[model samples]
Target: VSLSLALKGFGAWAPTIGWCAHQTQTCILLWAVSRLRPKLCWDKHRIKEMLSYGLGVSASGWVWYLKTLINPLIVGRFAGETAVGQIALAIRMLEVLSFAKAATYRISIAALAQLQSDGKRLKQAISEGMELQLLALGPILVLASWIGPIVFPLMFGEEWIPAMSIFPLLGVTYLTNAAFNLHCSTLYVLRRNWEVTAFHAAYVILFGILAFFLVPHSGIAGYAWAEVLSIVTYVVAHLSIHRLIGSPNYQIAAIWWAGFTIAMFSYQLGWWVVGGLGLAFLLPEARNRLTTYLKHFRALKTG
Candidate 1:
């Protein structure tokens, strides 16, 4: 079967654990919001739009995963199951990072969609979201950057030693990736939907082509590098979209990227202290806004 056909089968054959977890997260958030605001309208068109957004984004994820799964299939058939199993387990571990980044993006989507105005509110929502994402992912990147290799052998077995060289790079790459994904919410909220699709295409096409040529020669390391390069391409495409949409304070982009790097590189001894400081800075603002949201939700429910 063709790769496309095979992927269709694979997607149907067994839902990925990652996909399942993501769907569960999305459903839980939607359910919580609905319960909090019982009167929110949910017509067919609205349901369709929500499903379209979720399914469209879900397909992008599945494309990368299907291709990742294919590599092990090819390896097991051509080389040996031991080689394939090592790569499979390693890839599974790498997927944990991808899912973490994706979950943050998903939250940003719901958060942005709840805000007012397609232009001003969307950008502000995304900016605030970028702050929260950096705060959440910063220490994670720090710990992973330092200990990715040490943890791998214990988690996936010593046979996966080849993955050691790739894991730290993969972790750092997630920092960039999480930043890029924050814009996905912006793209959708502003109705710049095609750009979102285009970037997802860029990620898959660039990664697939690079992996196609490089993996056979360089092994899982090649695959790892391909993924990192693809993430960079994804980030660039989002920046281009910002320009195309009339760039709104490129400072927003700078703040997110620079802040993430600073947070990641700061002294580990004081990182948690810094995180607490950030909460102190943001809490009053966040609390007031959340209180307003709850008031609206309560009014909707009571009505």
Candidate 2:
């Protein structure tokens, strides 16, 4: 719907949509500002920092959004709308799965800000956060595999059948992206935004280059492959950043490997049973993480 609105050309809807984004940013800014007191606070400097962080987040989102449109536009025009529409549906699933990590970013930022023991606690938090994210999203990846085919066509119209075929593969792409998000949140909280941009730029470039050849030969599957490859590369770069900042708990490496293995094997299991069980395993982990996160949130509210 948002895509369709944008495609109708910005003349009719740009102002309206732009206003919606403005209102959202304004609300965030106001809320942030309200937390400050004029006499007690470093008002100007803090406001500048808040706005800068907001812009970084917003710009990152905008860049991805532009590419999101560009990729589909080319595919739809050159390859055929059915193929493009199908890929678009697949990408939409990716977006839905990816939102889970947005929460991870918020949580990581809070953790980094409050937890004073940066060396030990920061490492633990990053590990725990990744574990929490994996446990939360692992089964979702399974469910997407099981039901995406049926759901995609129903949601986007039957013209999206090819999209369904490639949908399961793209589920891994989302998983990789979630992992990348964890790395990003940790990095950003530690003040490594430039690294994030560089990591993404390199990954996006490589993925685009791969897609030029792969898309023609493999169609939507190629696109899925490109996404997974790029995200995995970004994840590696993030690990490098973690090391540069300082060693996080080395245990995080093992957990990441284990989580990836679980995700890989689980994807093979038929959606209903395998995905359902994976989610069941995820519940306790999620409960613990959510509880910890909420405690911090409440503390922040009061403090």
Candidate 3:
């Protein structure tokens, strides 16, 4: 739809039209397959139950979304429209690259909820989920970080090249997100929404503060570094999950994450990319886990 519109010289309306068309199709498909009809009804008790659970999720989501505005508001104020555009481009690129991580996070919520009553299973599930998320994300990040500098200027325009400077930093930030986002999901499954809300609040607040101070001094790259530094605060979510289900052994994942992050940051220096990936792939624990995961996936496919 978008491509057709763009080709027809109506490119400005293509994205909106395409999005509406996709949503309309989804709604129609759900109506046909779900086989449920809405009835006019009112139930105060049910409303109260839903509000109790939903309000926290909504509140946390709203607060979490505020981080998105920091670049526009803070960076725009400190730098200018050009800086904001560069940051926006970098963020859009990350969004596209992080799609798999986002999908897994959503699906894992229901899966984690089923195991909520079993601590051992819950911890194991979180560990496995994190490993798979990293495995899926690592290659995409590496490839993008490697080729983006070369391809982006040609594809987008020479004016957008500066965006690639901070792309790797934001990539590492998303990589860290893949590592710990399931902890947030675990909190939700346990009905600990307020804790998640608190963590998100702190996250936005910290990002806002860092952007405020850094953008003026260091430019957009400062904004990216702020995101990388804010990852340390994920410990709040980690501790919250630990108190409930005990934390998973992240030793193996941590080593790989560190190596991958360095590789991305130094990919321009030539050998860091190979060295970092080599370290991650050669780790005995990571190789064993990957083998086990592949076997399980094959069994599920065949069975």
Candidate 4:
């Protein structure tokens, strides 16, 4: 079955091609490597350690899968298809946020794992990782929030107009998660895997609980608010676990929250763009960084 579907990918019908191709290629490479290094030693203790790690990974995967998978059912049951559809549509925007986060995680897990025992380096890495996440996702968040209402209604038709309302709040959810997303990786790399899983489990339960109260009363936006609440709870837990495990004191960032609040108010006052641009200057450090980036870009163009 896998073979036929993989073959179908050659004809450009790659429905399940990624998983099939990745597995097949991995097995083939591993077999080749084994044949090339036939005297490879297998350590029982090391295997056991890896197995423990794998178990934690498996639990986390299943827990999160169930969380995401079950969310739609709750939405559909409580809020109906229109709300579900709106949420589903808004989620496509989340993929954009995920891409920014994925890059930060890849670098963070690698760097943090190397510096796990060094308090100074780990702190530096964590601080910088959070900064990079903000740098990457910040402007995107601002632009999307500013433009989505005007764009989504036109882009997806009138039925999806409802999505524009909930999406900005979900963008807030994504932004909140990004603040502590790297901490989850740091916890996992430190072998505090269960903590990460526990955080996610709490997120799932809290989301469901919030959904329970909000969905029936507030409709689709209720689901979005539920997500916001869940993101807040989970990120707080993630950071507390980080500190409990001896991670450096990362300054709880209120800049984004403050800026967002101001922007929302400015938006109400019909000066959203001006207000959002004002955020760049909210912090002296951010202002300097923007100036440096602009200067470098100008230099590059001139030279």
Candidate 5:
């Protein structure tokens, strides 16, 4: 709320001001709510122990942040500012659509860390996380894709229509991200930070290479396709997690993901949106899963 209001008032300076205000507010709230305080003393052994773990997490984070730079540095060089803008618009839309993934990611790390020692419980947690994420994200994605063509021009201006071409493809990318995000969190909770780091490194490298080769020829759509294709590499994370704590129940999640992807693409392709929606929402298994989740939510609320 502060950020939005700041944007309205401060315009370009809003981010810096809003971020400072937000952080200050968070600090104050934490200070008020928590009993913890900073100590003036430190232990060398504990410091070293923390650095050993913290360094790996920080390394993975830095590598992940490199992804944000690839498009501007690579795509801008190859495709020009217009193409970069289109891809940016698509990515921004995707980020908004991926709110559920972002929220679950933070929670999963803590929750899965507790279950890391038990393979059965860990697997169940991961499966439930994926299901709940998809259930929350799927309909919103479908609705956005359905209305985007009509709304994008009106909202962001007609100049950004090219972004619509690749929005669904990037939607697929985020959908996959939402589904498998827990696997990444699982690796982190298990203290396999380097493994996650390796995955991030590989993804950045693959995306860069794909953009370098494809963007010059295919433009922004090429960039979007690169995103979609690079997500296939998440198979590496899946394999890593399987070796650690077995695999989650991907069967149902896969059905919904596929249907959502097709539905998003249907706007670009043809009338396949009907088939996609049917597959996602109408399947007996899909319906049953939805009902199960709803009941679970209601039970929790009522209980």
Candidate 6:
């Protein structure tokens, strides 16, 4: 609200100040809310433990900022803003598909945290979470595939038509990223930050090297593929590590993923409907776990 009003008032002459005004108002509101709720308390020992885990989480953020920044930095430096704009456009379009992924990442900790700290529960949560994410993300991607080409040019005009080439690969990247989110969250729940941190660092380094070669060769298309490839690497790394640590049947989600893709490309709603029913028989336990996860989320939300 403040942002919109400030942009209206000062945007014509000094647009940068608009965000500054908005941020000031936002901070004041946040401060007021914190005061009303009053969450923090002084406990030195507990604070010390919290700070250590918080720093691990904070370290992952720095790794992410660097990981996502490298390719665009390379693209902007070599290929110019037009390429940057196309990359941004493709990613922005893809972000819509991550809605369920983002929400699950944010909210499922409470449920997963409650599941008795046993192998069966942990494995159930991890594997079923993957299936639920596949179900959530796949239909939307298929739906978007039907409309995106037609909608892209109309929505943003013909200048962005070239970006459509990069769209599918970016969709794949976001699919892989959704899995990455769950794995990262699972790792956080399990207090396995050492390996997670190491993997993030390695991913960024490997992604930078791939981008160095890719962006120069195939322009934005190559860079998009690099992102996809690196994301696949992250997923594989997590799957392997997850298995080594505990969850043995992590690859089970691949069947659903393949089915979803095939049904999507086949463009068969009946097949999807049948597939939805089939999941109940094939993975009834998983369906139940997902139901429980959602009910837990709803309880948390309404509370």
lDDT of 6 by residue, 122-149 (tens): 6667676777787678768756765777
Full-model lDDT for every candidate: 0.60, 0.63, 0.88, 0.70, 0.85, 0.70
**Count of backbone collisions within predicted model 2:** 0
lDDT (Cα) of model 5 = 0.85
Candidate 4 TM-score, C-alpha based: 0.77
Report the lDDT tens digits of candidate 5 across residue range 171-277: 88788888888888989888999999988888888988897888889988778888778996888888888888887899788888877778877655788676766
Residues 1-303 of candidate 3 have per-residue lDDT tens digits of 988998888867998899999999999999999998879989999999899999999998999999999988999999999999999999999999899999998898988889989999999888877778888897799788888888999999999998999998999989988988788899999999999998888888888899899999999999998888888789889889899989898977887787777778665667746786777767898778778889999999999
Instruction: Give every collision pair in model 3.
Output: none
Higher-ranked by lDDT: 1 or 6: 6
* Candidate 2 per-residue lDDT over residues 154-176, each given as its tens digit: 77777667766666567666665
Selected candidate, larger lDDT, 2 vs 4: 4
Give the C-alpha lDDT of model 6: 0.70
Error of model 3, residue 99, in angstroms: 1.3
Please give the ranking of all candidate structures by lDDT, highest first, separated by commas.
Answer: 3, 5, 4, 6, 2, 1
Q: What are the runs in model 3 whose C-alpha is more than 4 Å off?
A: 1-21
Q: Estimate each model's TM-score.
A: 0.61, 0.68, 0.92, 0.77, 0.91, 0.76
Which window of 10 residues has the lowest lDDT sum in candidate 4?
Answer: 260-269
lDDT of 3 at 110: 88
State each model's C-alpha RMSD to the native: 9.5, 6.3, 2.2, 5.4, 2.6, 5.2
Error of 5 at 88 (Å): 1.7
Which portions of model 5 show Cα errors greater than 4 Å? 1-14
Candidate achieving the largest TM-score? 3
Scored by lDDT, the top model is: 3
Query: Candidate 1's residue-wise lDDT over 41-70, tens digit each?
Result: 759998998887777666655554555554
